[model samples]
Target: MNHFIEKTLQLKDPNITIDTEKVDEVKVNGRFSLIYYGKLSYTPKACECCGIINNAFQVVKNGYRTDSRITLNTISAMPAYLKLKKQRFSCRECG
Candidate 1:
């Protein structure tokens, strides 16, 4: 499943991951595009302020923001709308 998603999405690295189980469908709203809802995250996040790397320790999911971006992939002769849950991380040590 992971391999298929990596290939389909053209993900180059293992650190960059996506949760495909969160969404059930490739929503076809009209003739313009398809919407794919998913969560996006990067492993071994680093603190923006302190430059501290957190693989697990002192790391927390502060919040997530809904983000939309244009991808090179096309679906049904239309562009793909990747609705991503962009994760925000914080470090307890930095705070």
Candidate 2:
């Protein structure tokens, strides 16, 4: 949904760029779904001794529980399915 993508961009910092083409549509219960795939520019800081940034990694998917009753409502009332994609990195500077 355009609205969903717009909302997502609004929530992020202005410096971040979202890749809209990476978004995918999945069929859930015979209904269309929207998925987003993209990466933002991130700066990696190193410790005082070693100044090398760590390697990049792929993102992971996260899921959440939904209210069955609300989800069973009319398709119009049902909200879009959202899967949050995020990555985890370890920094020796902070560790």
Candidate 3:
């Protein structure tokens, strides 16, 4: 569950959701590692580019960027990582 991961990782962001669909277990440098995927998405209250309120149209979802690789404290002596998919927002009024 998303809450389980958030609690475990001590994440305070409500917009972040842990994607447990397919957890990756890979070998790196001859050692095994675990990778967790997380997605960050939220509607913007205001446009950062023009400072205009969303109002259902001013700002819109602009898809997500590639997952970023972030190192985490090793779990049980094995390396751990997080692949975060950050959402993008575009301001229609500014564009």
Candidate 4:
């Protein structure tokens, strides 16, 4: 299921996992769009902002960026989108 969507949409990010059974039709800026739900998560080896190594008491899961809409190439002439809940990390050393 995940593999099918990835191949069809050309999404190569390993962190992204699509909910293949779920899809929605919605309006974006007055135009109809097709949206697919998914989640993005990964364990980081280092903090992206401060470059501090990730470990105990270092970079950790802050929460997530939810309902982020990313545009994709049109599917069957309709605008396609990915609604992703992306994992986020916070650097204890920097913040």
Against the true structure, whose TM-score is highest?
3
lDDT (CA) for every model shown?
0.65, 0.42, 0.84, 0.89
Candidate 3 lDDT by residue in tens digits, 9-89: 677889888886767899977899988889899988998877998887878888999989888878778898888999998
How do all the candidates rank in terms of lDDT, highest first? 4, 3, 1, 2
| lDDT, candidate 1, at 10 | 77
Per-residue lDDT tens digits for candidate 4, residues 26-68, read: 8988999999999999889998888887767598777888688
- TM-score for each prediction? 0.62, 0.35, 0.87, 0.82
| lDDT over C-alpha atoms for residue 87 of model 2 | 32
Consecutive 10-residue window with the lowest summed lDDT within model 1? 22-31
TM match of model 1 to true structure: 0.62
Single out the weakest 10-residue window by summed lDDT for candidate 3: 2-11
Q: Write the per-residue lDDT of candidate 2 for residues 7-88, one digit (tens) a residue.
A: 6445344433445556556677786755444433444344334545544422222232331211212233433433443333
Q: How close to the true structure is residue 1 of candidate 4, measured as C-alpha lDDT?
A: 71
Report the C-alpha lDDT of model 1 over 15-85, residue by residue, as the tens digit. Answer: 54566675333445545565555666664467778878775577777777757564648745766666667
Where model 4 places Cα greater than 4 Å from the true spot, the runs are: none
